[model samples]
Target chain A: DTAVSQTPKYLVTQMGNDKSIKCEQNLGHDTMYWYKQDSKKFLKIMFSYNNKELIINETVPNRFSPKSPDKAHLNLHINSLELGDSAVYFCASSQDLRNYGYTFGSGTRLTVV
Target chain B: TQLLEQSPQFLSIQEGENLTVYCNSSSVFSSLQWYRQEPGEGPVLLVTVVTGGEVKKLKRLTFQFGDARKDSSLHITAAQPGDTGLYLCAGDVTGQGGKLIFGQGTELSVKP
Candidate 1:
């Protein structure tokens, strides 16, 4: 049983298109987050939600939006994707935003042409 | 923004060899964590150290937190091919629920 799972393990699309990645966690965690790993393998946090409320929004662009309908699910929607968006997107969950470690999804590889 | 700097961005070693990865920061953290990630997967937490000068061991891996709470180190003993992956360290500054700052990460390749 996967603790956290993200859909569309692989996504390949063209520029100017919009896309969404879905994530779900069964760890009963109250906080969920979206992270991006660039080609250099640098993991950076993009957004975080606590109990369906936005709490942390890194310096990500407005084109990148995250929505949490509930405590168990958090989805990311990208508008007008560009080549720079090519990277691995990961979904993570924690007991709370202050937890030291978080459970993470396998990750979604997004490639924009 | 809190920053964690990791040294030796890349490491390659033969099976049975030993190595250590270091994560440092000028800021003091309430807690520090270590994670390992395989290709195509998100990072998995290995251990979390909260107290200064604390040390934790997991099988052949040993982790240590600096006394000042500003740095940490991960040492692997007799590393194997299965241990190859990207090692990352994250610092938690929030006392209760805050943000975590991650280091650049160390890519380790253990060849058999």
Candidate 2:
């Protein structure tokens, strides 16, 4: 079974359109994170949730919002996406907030035109 | 801002050749981790080094953490085609609220 799975492996949308990416983890981890990888392959943390509580919120734009309905699911919703939103997004989970045994999903490739 | 600087943004090597990748930072870290990412998949953890001056080996890959806990290195011996991927180093900065600061990453291409 896939430990961490992300829906819509690939997404293509137009500018000003809104989209959402879903992430779920079966690892029973307490902490989950959303990271964005740019064209240069630089990974940056966008948001993090620990047991359904917002823990880390980076300097991302207001258009990006993360919602965690439960401890095992964390979803990212982008409002009025722009061309610069084109990149790969990854979902990851760890047993604790300290980043022990971190596991990442395959990732979703978002292309905003 | 706490940042981990990875050197040699790109590396190409022939099979059986050995190479080393370095990750450095001025800020101290509580722990450090190494991850390898392929073409389409997310990164997979290779190893994690916590204590200062700690060294761990997995098969032909050896990882070392600096004594100051501010830097780390990854050494691969007898490189293979399967070793081709982007190597990333992340550190847990003190008082950052559990956020892992990542390095720029090193892309390795091993030709057989």
Candidate 3:
């Protein structure tokens, strides 16, 4: 089975629209993270959850919210998305928060028009 | 501030050519990892180097971590067209649990 999976591989929506991206990890990892890859190919961490508890919340705008129902799932919800929000969103999981490599999902490409 | 800075942001070379990518940081790290990302896919972990001055080899690819744990390098030998992708270096600073940082990444294009 795929280790980590993100739904809606591609998304295109009008500006100001709201959407949610779903992510699931079957690797039984303790920490799950959400990352945003920009047009410049820069990867930035947006949020991190360890066993359903929010740990790292970067300086992202309040429009983006992340919810973790359990240790295996972490979802990202964007409210009134803006044009600058168009980018690829990736979901990742790691057994440890400190020194281990992460397993990342295929990613969801969000395009705002 | 970008804690980790990667050099040679873009590299285009012919098949069978060798290349090296570098990741530098001022802050010390507990562990550093190398990942390769292709279009429409997430970055895949290629190797992890934790010890300072440690070197690891995976076939034609070689990874080295600085002795001070503040820098790292990836060397690919006789690269093939299939090796074209975005190479990223990420690290976890000492005692910072949630502060893992990723370099800007190097876009590698190996022409046939």
Best by lDDT: 2
lDDT of 2 by residue, A6-90 (tens): 9899999999999999999998999999999999999999998999999989999989999999999999999999999999999
Model 3: which docking level applies?
A: medium
lDDT for B112 in candidate 1 is 90
Estimate the TM-score of every prediction: 0.96, 0.98, 0.97
B16 Cα displacement, candidate 3 (Å):
1.6
TM-score of chain A in every predicted structure:
0.98, 0.98, 0.98
When superposed on Cα atoms, how far off is each prediction in RMSD? 1.2, 0.8, 1.1
What is the Å distance of residue A59 in model 1 from its true position?
1.7
Estimate, for each residue in B1-112, the C-alpha lDDT of model 3 and write its tens digit. Answer: 6399998999999999999999999988889999999999999999999999999999999999999999999999999999999999998866554556999999999999
Instruction: Using DockQ as the measure, name the better of candidate 2 and candidate 3.
Output: 2
lDDT of 3 at A86: 96
Q: Which stretches of candidate 1 lie over 4 Å from their true place?
A: B95-97
The reply for model 3, stretches above 4 Å from the true place, is none
Displacement of the residue A86 alpha carbon in candidate 1, Å: 1.2
Better of 1 and 2 by DockQ: 2
Query: What is the C-alpha DockQ of each candidate?
Result: 0.67, 0.74, 0.72
Model 2 pairs whose backbones collide: none
Please state what fraction of the native interface contacts candidate 1 reproduces: 0.63
lDDT of 1 at B18: 96
> Candidate 1's residue-wise lDDT over B41-68, tens digit each?
8999999999999999999999999999
Report the lDDT tens digits of candidate 3 across residue range A11-113.
9999999999999999889999999999998999998898899888888999999999999999999999899999999999989677579899999999999
Q: Candidate 2 lDDT, tens digit per residue, B22-96?
A: 999999998999999999999999998999999999999999999999999999999999999999999987665
